[model samples]
Target: MTSSTDRVAIVTGGSGGIGRVSVERLARDGLAVVVHYAGNKDRADETVASVVDAGGRAIAVGGDVADEHRMGAVFDAAEQEFGGVDVLVHTAGIMPLSPIAQLDLDTFDRVQRTNVRGTFVVDQLAAKRMRAGGAIVNFSTSVTRLQIPGYGAYAASKGAVEALTLILARELRGRDITVNAVSPGPTATPLFFEGKTPEQIDGIAGANPMGRLGTPEDIAEMVSFLAGPARWVNGQVLYVNGGAA
Candidate 1:
């Protein structure tokens, strides 16, 4: 395993929500981090400032996750700034909720482009460029198992992420790299709170055995593990849902 001091990580969607927290968490773990944002430059700057204040090395880069050229630039920025990438936590994704029958084809396509294609693009770059003993973590959703009514398209996108994660792990045979996915349950990020009623949120939180909503920090901790010492734990989707299953 690579030592934290020598490791470099690129965290896509590192500007806000779970991605923001994951950047800080990995930085705290002693890895130099490249924080990737889609359009929110201000938020991305804030995340970088927080890491700097904490005495961790970090730089923010902007790009659309699904765009191959843009994401290649993200990887390029990491190598230029910190040498080479050793870990990639791909948290950049969208969650647009709509029933399958009512969901427009455009929305469905957008969801796939961002979530599924995004994972593939970044994972491909990481597979080719990341140093040996690297880790590639893709984000998935617990809703795939929950089968929530309005999550059809979103869940379908994450399902593809999970499949890619498993296949990529096997594809990287003899490379000593670990590929895995983190399936998070209802997390209390802006994404989850948006369009959610208080009663609905409460009901969902109560359904979990932990009786509380998962936090961005909770998911970050899992990513930190996978990005570091969890070498034997590859090609698996570790669900971090507080026993919500």
Candidate 2:
């Protein structure tokens, strides 16, 4: 069995806001980290630097999450670097909003490709290769339940993610590996603020009972818990939205 301090984690989208925080949090917990970025090596390097500077082990790897061969190389890197993979924090996804009526089929396909297909690609690799005591924390959205307008395509992709998480948990039965998804609501990431106005942001922040946006650190705490101490928390979608849903 890998010691807690020697466990390894691969955090996809680790160049982005929430992913970067999750990587640092996991590294702080003593797990060596592989920071997976799609195309942003600079940001990914920054993420890796944070961990390395803190005296933790980390490396940056870039490739499309939906590319099996490419992402497989990412897993290979982790195994080569840290002995084996124990935790997979899959936070790689994209969001582009448009009402169903005005939806571009091309955009919808792209969303499905990146969000849904990308998850399947990485999860498939993790399912087969991750150590027995490992965990897989895939990202979903509260919009699946919130059913907000203009989120049709994005929500659909995540909906598939939730479904996949449930079944994967069962399929990994007796493997000691846990599979789950984190459903965040209106987080204050650049992804969330992409096409909205100040009024819109304020409106969203006010909609939640907490009356504030969720920080990346807020979500990273949950990721840390799931990737480490959340052994029994399998096949669940933890909605970390500050009581918004």
Candidate 3:
């Protein structure tokens, strides 16, 4: 009964924000999803509930993207449950924004560990397990293009991600797989609006050409395209920022 159409997917950081939305969208698009979260089992369970409610297949799994052994188990679980992975979405990242002059080495290290190294780890694992025609989509930030103030450390980490993705695309050319990054502008997620008031969030949204902060669903739509039936769209960093950057 199974074919390439029933292949599995893993979305890292699926507990919240864009990750949660991506998981739901991929499930709706008909891929069996492994909802990978670092912590927050409650939120992860909520994500799974949403997917199953919509008549999709999903399971919540916990692992640190930057940890190899833990990620290995995540891969093993996906294979055991759904046969093998055909899509990998690396959305697990940390962004602590501060000017380099005020930034401590510890903050920079953490950002790199989660955003840069974490991406590399997940991509490598996906490549190992994915069949030809598979896709690995990573997350980057539009700040790398806009060079926004107070985002030096965070942008540097994503900048590394951009570079890694370009090389990865070429490295896996023979496999007929696609590796790409999706760079999103400011969106109205808890991560983006955590401490901001409603007015503050509105002001941020008003700056975009679309006159609104992006929803997680907006980003998830792009992920769905890259993961399924868009195999020709490979190794490219598609921006979903609504002309803000």
Candidate 4:
């Protein structure tokens, strides 16, 4: 197992929601964290400040996840600031729900670009640069299995992520690095609550066997395990839903 001080991580979308909590968790675990944000510099700065206040090292970087050059700079910043990157938690994604029949072509393309293309760009960079013992964790959704209506476009994007997660793990065979995806079900994040009503939210929570919404920390704990000592658990998509699927 790698000691926390020797580990460095770049957490995309680390400025908010699940990403923010993951940053804090990893920092507390002693990893120097690079918090990547697409916009919202203030939130990113806040996250970094929180990490530092807790006596952990952290820096905030900004970039579009789909832009290869820009994301390359994100990796560059991590290496320049904290030696080399050891873990990457790709938590940046967009979910614009629409039925296939009514889904705007523009919206569909945008989602694909951010969710699918973005994962490809970052994963490619991580695969090339991460050290032998590194780990790459991509975010996916349980909706792909739930097959809920109005989630066709969103699910399709994440479906691509799941495919990449599996194929990339196999591609990295001889390397000690592990690649996996975390599929969370109905987490209590702003993204999940954006267009949802209280009744709708309650319905989703009740659908899970645990009868509650998953928390960002719940997902982060699993990520911490994968990013650190879970060496044998590769090429798998661990669904973090409460037995929802």
Q: What pairs collide in candidate 3?
A: none
The digit string of per-residue lDDT tens for model 3 on 110-184 reads 999988889888888887888777889999989899887888988998989989888999999789889999999
Per-candidate TM-scores read 0.99, 0.99, 0.95, 0.99
Runs off by more than 4 Å, candidate 3: 1-5, 197-200
- Compute the lDDT for candidate 1: 0.95
Clashes of each: 0, 0, 0, 0
Candidate 2 Cα deviation (angstroms), residue 59: 0.2
Clash count, candidate 3: 0
lDDT of each: 0.95, 0.94, 0.88, 0.96
lDDT of 2 by residue, 176-242 (tens): 9999999998898999999899999999999999999999999999999989888889999999999
Give the better candidate number (1 or 3) by TM-score.
1
- TM-score for predicted model 4 compared with the true structure: 0.99
lDDT of 3 at 120: 84
Cα lDDT tens digits, model 1, 33-123, are 9999999999999999999999999999999999999999999998999999999999999998888999999999999999999999999
Give every collision pair in model 4: none
TM-score of 1: 0.99
Deviating ranges (above 4 Å) for candidate 4: none
